[model samples]
Target: MKRICILLILLFIAFNNSFGQQVLKKGFLVACGDDKLFIIDPNKSNNNHTEIIWKWVVSEAKSLPAEYIPLLKSLDECKPVMGNKKILVNSSSGATILVDIASKDVEFYAKTPMSHSVDLLPKNRIVVANSTHPKGNSIELYDLNKNEKVLFTDSLYSGHGVVWNPKDNLLYVLGYQLLKTYSLINWDTENPSLKLESSWRISDKSGHDLFRIDADNFLISTHNSVFLFNTSIKSFTDFTLLKGKKDVKSVNYYPKNNSLIYTIAEESWWTENIYMVNPNKTIKLPNLKLYKVRKAI
Candidate 1:
């Protein structure tokens, strides 16, 4: 028993990457819930948890009625967008916001009818999936240039998240009720065309989200597992986190340090700390909640 316990302890440290002391630095994770955004710096101390660096007050603006300003759902979308220091937030009533990290700039904001999930396309436009019942599977593409644009509402019953394939004008989608991918070749096509290339049949799957990591790779998260896939390879031998089985809720990837940012469900909002994944490490605490911990690509 002593030997077994000792081995487990060593493995725990190894998984957390304590041996090298190469803890994640500089970057932070942002999460949103009940209209508040949170920032976490893991590895400091359990006593010192993710703090609310800053927040955006969405009260009623006399002109636009802050009351009309949407409220964000999960902390996942609240975390910074991939390759950006800006955070992506969606209002329960259907507003999309991009919050800048350093400058604290609300760089952009758009309104939609989406319920829980939102995505920013390569064209600088935003897309959001609904939260209500199925049958109205629609993706609202919001154009900042004008308070309007086209919406892809065909065959999309519901969506968990949307991702832009930079290499090609394509969107990867996941949702509570379905998981599918659409090639937006029609965005610029004469008739505005979309091709349903590939998809996974999913039902009763909540908190499902799809994130684009690179041209050939992406990440998908569920209540209990997170997967990494290589589009080029079309096969994924992914990582399984020890976080509570509740749909990872959301996830983010940082391009600056090549790290995956993620959060686990906690009792108190503050208890939900964010961790940076160290892909090189192969061992860890059973069901450990970590971010940026991925395989060598």
Candidate 2:
């Protein structure tokens, strides 16, 4: 009994120390840009110019599989999946891939012309959007319970951003000039389908990304500016974080850590041509232009 008690005490101390020594309080931010992906730690790196903790280049990805070779072109959206153990990436060249963080094992799920964004849903369903290609200009839902299979389809023009919000049981999709919300009822059933609930005109040109500020609020990125949409009021208030440039690509909000990371591009695709927006100011890095940014938390 005394030996067992001593072992328990030691385990408790080790657990406590691990938690106390945790440094990446805001977790890591995965930024995907032109054929490259970077992991940035907010708490550890310099606030002025945060360094990338890790990076994956196109050369390494091209060696994986012949099907995944297309993923080497214009990697737009990279999202942490399965508790940041893996990453789901969407490229402009009709490739949707999920990669293991440790082994770098790649899984090619679906292909569409100009695939832009992918969001993980309940029951291992992956929802994807394609920006170009006439046949691919629609929202495609794939079920990964067994193999990847098309479960549903909804038509949209310039489909770019998609997010499944459990707070209101709604799936929000963004097109070029319209924002649509669908009721995610019957989602757990075999024949589950989303019903269109609401639609709004967000931008006349390009709508880029969506960040959930809360249960009833969201920050939407566009080619012109960012807008805060209030679900209760069904109205939009433009918050132009960038004054002169219309290149704000992505925004990620970490509520637990009270941190926000956004990317803006200038004339080039280099990180020096991009800026990372913090709460008070923006930090410029000499790296690749970031297309999508996601907090690992």
Candidate 3:
């Protein structure tokens, strides 16, 4: 009887451990205008309750120079990269940095005019989308090993977002009223550049955010509404959930759980709240000036 009881207890503990492993760990990484990035649990976070699991302040970054602080003001993008081992972040204030998650070290940094989004590329390369500043309105490429030096530039009017699609091995860029794809030309060589392969007109003008939904689709937000662009079909369709919701600043969708988290520009270009659906939670960070929310991977 004693041996049977011990066996039952061990089985129970094993079962609980297996169940815990099956549960998904859900969290979000938010970029704020106050030059900070926060990873928070929406289920446990609210205006009165704070459940920030991790935070990074741009001005306090040890690897950044003192003078560069002013240029990284409005932290707009914080994207998980390198299999979530690192984060790629940039600001509308014209600075981008790749940070090591565990060490909190800035691995790569660049200064671009009105940089709104960024993505990693093959061969230690990075691409930035520059918006409507004097030196903006272009897609700029840089080497991670060489800081502050632009390797290449291509004109993309009012560029707002960039994402690398590994399935097709093309770089997708979002600009005013257009979504374009580029093939890497001479990437293995020192004189690397992007060759325009194709372009598609967005359903609306003022394209804002472009994020991968899966291998075949991308989540795009414009001034008027959000859409899903099918890479295979080369078409755009309204994202039914936020179909007509205007001024959506950023959006991320998890198909596994059918969950989504997004930010809307409520007060001009920023909001004080981050919203989630499919579970229906609102995480309010009063006075934080939240700009974008990407799923913490």
| Predictions in order: lDDT | 0.52, 0.71, 0.84
Compose the digit string of candidate 1's lDDT tens values, residues 1-297.
Answer: 999999999998786554222221245334455555545443332433333334444441222434345433322255345344456666544666666544444555655555456666655566676554443346666643444355445446555677777686667777664566777755653344457888765323554567677787776776656666667756654544423345465565656576555555454322334445553211222222222211111
Candidate achieving the largest TM-score: 3
Q: List the lowest-lDDT window of 10 residues for candidate 3.
A: 19-28
Q: Across residues 23-78, which tens digit of lDDT does each residue of candidate 3 receive? A: 22446454556688776767777546767766777755777777778887798888
> Candidate order by TM-score, highest to lowest?
3, 2, 1
Candidate 3 regions with alpha-carbon error over 4 angstroms: 1-28, 46-48
Choose 1 or 2, whichever is better by lDDT: 2
Pairs clashing in candidate 3? Answer: none
Q: TM-score winner between 1 and 2, please give it.
A: 2
Per model, how many backbone clashes are there?
22, 2, 0
What TM-score quantifies how close candidate 3 is to the native fold? 0.88
Residue 230, model 2: lDDT of 85
Q: What TM-score does each of the candidates earn?
A: 0.64, 0.80, 0.88
Q: Identify the leading candidate in terms of lDDT.
A: 3
Model 1 steric clash total: 22
